[model samples]
Target: MTISTNSLMSLREYFSNQQILICFNGPISTNLIGEIGSALKEHIESNHAPELEVMDVFSVYIEMSQNIRNYATSHGFSDSESSATVVIAAAEAGHYAVCAGNLVEMGDGQALLERIHELAACDKAQLKLLYKQQLRQPHTQTPGQGAGLGLIEIARRSSQPMEASLDPLEPGRAFFSLRAII
Candidate 1:
């Protein structure tokens, strides 16, 4: 299928208008993530962002991307199913927004959405206290037991509350998207 020039131009304009710095959509892997992370770091640094801000944005990007990758791996999803869309952009109030999305089972997506909501409701201090408490807890090697610490860490690093959504898709599955602002 050929992409028309007009479509490409429109897409570029949309990205520019949205303040997107970097975007990716495909099967996610550790190496791919590392490469994209390097680019993200350079982009933020080039923008003259503070060291702390750059680190925080990069951390959130890593966490969100890894979460998508891990979920797809644990669920034994196909490459198509495992494909993820991640975007990093400048956000309101000079913040950086890191968003990642992938397919998930219906139940799993709902549960994750609920968890994100719970985290979103917490104040910064509350998030920090929760992070500390989670740190003190025992580690479990159970598969798909996620979101334990990484999600909390993202919330702690974010300047604004994190957000998530579940959109219905194929039968028994949905698209799960998460956003964090740093």
Candidate 2:
């Protein structure tokens, strides 16, 4: 099934039984991702979840947030001045999901969606090879953004393949929603 592109709140009702490990959005940067990761790590520790489980959530969140940072900077998306909104939340059933939405040029959406579809169809071994190959390839200079290996990385890290959707906002811009679950 395709991943839900809707807001997380619409995905399900919050549970009293489950703790919100972390949630934040606005201006993605390496520092912001690190800070959120640190906070979630603390939350997980206090909640007494297993160390491995906490580490998994922390790692995945960092990667997804970093992707948002890259995409926003490449697209020049600024809220106040230089702020992007990205959310990472830990849920029940040992699930941790990261969602990042941003404004992207229409041209960029097609390549990203194709990559998502390609990643979703690949097996683990193929994904590993593709990741390595991408790292080795010459970088192409796109007009508005860097080439997207981040989405592939997210798909590789996820227990399930990454999910993404595009919503048209205007003539030349669209809202891109990406989610990875670990």
Candidate 3:
């Protein structure tokens, strides 16, 4: 399909208004993760972002991207369903918004939303405590089979509570999006 010049310009305007530095929509793979992640790091560093902030933003991007990939692989999702949309944009107060969305089982999406809400309710101290508690528990060594530590790690790095949304796409399926402010 050919994209018209007007539509392309509109997208450019929209991205400019949003201060979006990077946007991707496609099937995510490990190699793709590294390539995009490298680009993100370079972009952030070029803007003279603080060293710590750059690391935090990059870390969150990797964790979210990996989570989407692993979940899709483990769940045996089709290529179309496994495709991911990731956006990283500049926010107020020198903060960065790292957001990712992918199709998920309806039940899984609802459960994830609930989990995010629970984490959002916790204060920094509580989150720290929970992170420690999670560490002491037995966890699988594999990617997707872990003890849910990745989300906690992302939460810890976030300057504010993470936000998530689940939009129904079809029966027994929904598009789940997660945003972490770092």
Candidate 4:
């Protein structure tokens, strides 16, 4: 499906019976994450949905947002530059999906794809173990930015395997998109 960029700009798009799109931009700050998290929690609760589902959304949202924050710092993606956007939208499948796209060095795309492919193949049990292992590893963050544990946590929580793509932007930069459904 052709997902329009504008569809992700407003949370209203995700509020209906089948979907809700929660989108954010730029460098992620703690305050912004809290606000976004609260808004999503309130959105789910306002619908009178089960607390379980709301918690699911909350957990997934935190992971996705943190990914964006890390990407900004790791890849030098700035919010004002229009090179990064993070979106969390609920779908008809009864799952909430998180998607983040940002600019990165073209050289990193291949390695990122390889990492995503590895995570996608891992089962939940394996993902949980990986999350714990990665968490314990000293945060050897790369040059620009990254916390490094977000993906393992995402894989652990997502109902399905994580999905990602690297699209070319410029000669030296590419757009990386990652999605997970919970």
Among the numbered candidates, top TM-score falls to 1
> Tens digit of lDDT per residue, candidate 4, span 1-182?
66567875443444553354576667667678889889989987887878987887788778766665666665555665334577777764667777777677777766877888999999988888888888788776365444347667767778889899999877887888888787
Candidate-wise lDDT, in order: 0.92, 0.70, 0.92, 0.73
Residue-wise lDDT of candidate 3 within 131-174, one digit each (tens)?
A: 99998987776645621778888889999999999999889999
Candidate 2 structure quality by residue, lDDT tens digits, 1-182: 65475654554445323444455646666876787778878977887888876777677677666666766676667753235456666644677777667667777877787778888999889988888998898787764354356556677778877888988877987777777777
Once superposed on the true structure, which residue ranges of model 1 sit more than 4 Å away at CA? none
Which candidate, 2 or 4, would have the higher lDDT against the true structure?
Answer: 4
The TM-score of candidate 2 is 0.74
Residue 52 miss distance in model 1 (angstroms): 0.4
Query: Which parts of model 3 have CA positions greater than 4 angstroms off?
Result: 141-143
Model 4 regions more than 4 Å off: 1-18, 25-29, 74-79, 141-147
What is the lDDT for 30 in model 1?
A: 97
Error of 2 at 156 (Å): 1.4
Q: Estimate each model's TM-score.
A: 0.97, 0.74, 0.96, 0.76
Ranking by TM-score: 1, 3, 4, 2
Off by over 4 Å in 2: 1-20, 48-52, 80-83, 139-148
User: Where does candidate 3 clash, by residue pair?
Assistant: none
lDDT of 1 by residue, 16-84 (tens): 999999999999999999999999999889989999999999988998898888889999999999999
